[model samples]
Target chain A: MLFLRDFGPTEVGGFGISSANDLLLVEDIELVHQACSAVHVTFHDESVADYFDRQVDAGHTPAQCGRIWLHTHPGNCPLPSSTDEDTFARVFGKTDWALMFILARDGATYARIRANTGPGVQQELSVVVDYRAPFAASSESDWEKEYLANVHDAALNTKDTTVKDRDKSRSDRFDEWDESDFCDPLLQTQLRGY
Target chain B: MKVLVINNDGGGFADYMDVEPNTTVATLFGQVTKSSRAEDYLIRVNRQPCAADQILQDGDRISFTPTKIEGAAS
Candidate 1:
């Protein structure tokens, strides 16, 4: 909650990690390197792939590591935006099941699960926080490190720009730049979703 | 032949399904996922990544999981 609140008006994205014994029980939140604005977050694809491999190496399945997509909504409305819906459809459409969850700044939240097996079915889910379960003590320092490492806020200096304008600017910048500026050459090939 | 199919896509579930003899992983994937491309998923047999043409055994375990997911805000 504190991590979600720390970003204030900018959005943050993470994955809900659950155990094999209980898929619906989100035991942890895992954040990867991403470039985020107030309305969209583009995860570094290689980082996500690496995270997936790590989870598999640790004996966790991909479903346990990546099924639940969680993000924060800077506005009061927690409803899925067109971009959110489009992303959900494109990325998770083939999965047997997937979950999308959003938490708004005003404490409002929205959650839904989509099942694609047999006949496709989607149902809204209620958000619940189980306080009775044992959890690790809040590590502000660790969170700070994670947040610093993963979240590159595109809104930091572009606060005056509208979301659309920021997006356009980013696209324009990309068009003019070359892959040499990127830290990894693979990033050039993996920049598909934003 | 009955094989354990564990689809790790959305609601990851493990279930037993009867397959015809000599069914390949590619054939089973096409049957279950219908329109999904084989390249978009990681198909494994008995916990190891297998070739699409690999034939399933009577008690083999199979799983399919997507390789990419993108999360966005409104």
Candidate 2:
């Protein structure tokens, strides 16, 4: 589970790791560091291409590298609109494998995976939780406690506390902690008609 | 004078080439790629985008970044 420092809009690029045992670990998030307007996130393909180069330089094979991409949504909608699919297909369709993760404002998560083929295969995945052991207090945030408390039938009426409180707490967080890794797992509990 | 050329397309490599003085970026692009294909790329001089007609400066880091990035807002 990740939390944003400020609820300000951003488009981050990252990848996920998955195994045959239904285990997923989303890692290596790269935020767009370029300057752009608030409504748009401008990035060059070379940046991602450079990322792949550096990953290989670090001895990670291409297969071990993440091909999936992640970004955030201003709304709590967990469904992928046609634009998302189209973009995914256009950019990552020919790749060996890829996935897209959308983190919503209310913290809901929507994930889809594509297989390695000529055009690729598309499938929606259910974000699930089977309960892991208690994490260290330093490793997790108090937000999880608040999230679990309001997990049932969570609703938003234009005044969301999750993102607001996060912005307030950003200064208190460790400087090294990435504020963009903002998906709380409890968000799945809020999924409607998954 | 020498200029750095980094092509974003396949077979791209960061290489330097000798050129005559006052050579414009457009002329250099034509000399290196042998085509006007720079039109498909977003050309930048020293990390700042420049017009093709802008004169090149010695030791400037020019990069040709492909414009075909695919993504969408949710």
Candidate 3:
């Protein structure tokens, strides 16, 4: 089942909303389950970019592939902020079929679904999860299961070479910096959603 | 030691405060929520779901956020 929440009017450019369902369902149910169990979530720039490129290559119109993005926040508030808006514009600007979801520690979450309505203008629909339910167990033929297993195994093994290299550089830099130069900034702003 | 207090409802900014060691999440909540109702916000430690009674550690990231916010398309 899919869930959505309606934002009355505080959202800029349109109503802001969020969702918690799997995005692969927009493609195929079997694929969705395969993705959940077989695919591991990883953060690598090229991996993410290739994932998007593959969607387009798979013949999904820019609007039908429907991308889902998730991030965690420290607090419970589920509202998106100006920074979120800027980030969303940069990330999803090219895709009319993207959905953004923000998960917060407070069990609060938000999502917004975007689709093209016409040329130069688009519509964003909001949805929120009322409650989280257990994902159903799936059964697949031996061959299908094996295929998914292989795909996921390979994806997981894909190395995050960039992150490792960057971390190494940062570590070396930290060793050279004066400890007193690192002062924590005062946080006076409220957490905002994206 | 100084810790960051971020409230999502007011803005997506972080603030630093000097806090004592071994402070419980509940204790910090008390300090922050003194002017507001406790029920109005949700708090998390280190980006994970945490309970009020949970103990806080040094360098832990604490975020306070509302349960939900709705806005119409502008």
Give each model a TM-score: 0.63, 0.46, 0.31
Candidate 1 residue-wise lDDT, B27-66, digit = tens: 9998776645776666777767889899999999787655
For A96-154, candidate 3 gives per-residue lDDT tens digits of 35555654444666767565335535344455433454343443454344233222222
Clashing pairs in 2: A2-A181, A2-A182, A3-A182
Better of 1 and 2 by TM-score: 1
Stretches > 4 Å off in candidate 2: A4-7, A16-24, A32-39, A116-120, A128-194, B1-67
The alpha-carbon deviation from the true structure for residue A78 of candidate 1, after best TM-score superposition, in angstroms, is 0.9
The numbered model that scores best in TM-score is 1
* A165: Cα error in model 2, Å: 22
lDDT of candidates 1 onward, in order = 0.72, 0.52, 0.41
Model 2 chain A scores worst on lDDT over the 10 consecutive residues at: A150-159
Please report the TM-score between candidate 2 and the true structure: 0.46
User: Comparing candidate 1 with candidate 3, which one achieves the higher DockQ?
Assistant: 1
Q: Write the residue-wise lDDT of candidate 2 on B9-60 in tens digits.
A: 3333456777788999888777655446565555777666689899988887
**Ranking of all candidate structures by their lDDT, best first:** 1, 2, 3
- Report lDDT (Cα) of residue A174, candidate 1: 79
- Please identify model 1 stretches exceeding 4 Å from their true place: A155-194, B1-72
What value of lDDT does candidate 1 attain over all alpha carbons? 0.72
Interface RMSD of each: 4.3, 6.0, 17.0
Kindly report the docking quality category of candidate 1. Answer: acceptable
User: Per-residue error at A47 for model 2, in Å?
Assistant: 1.8
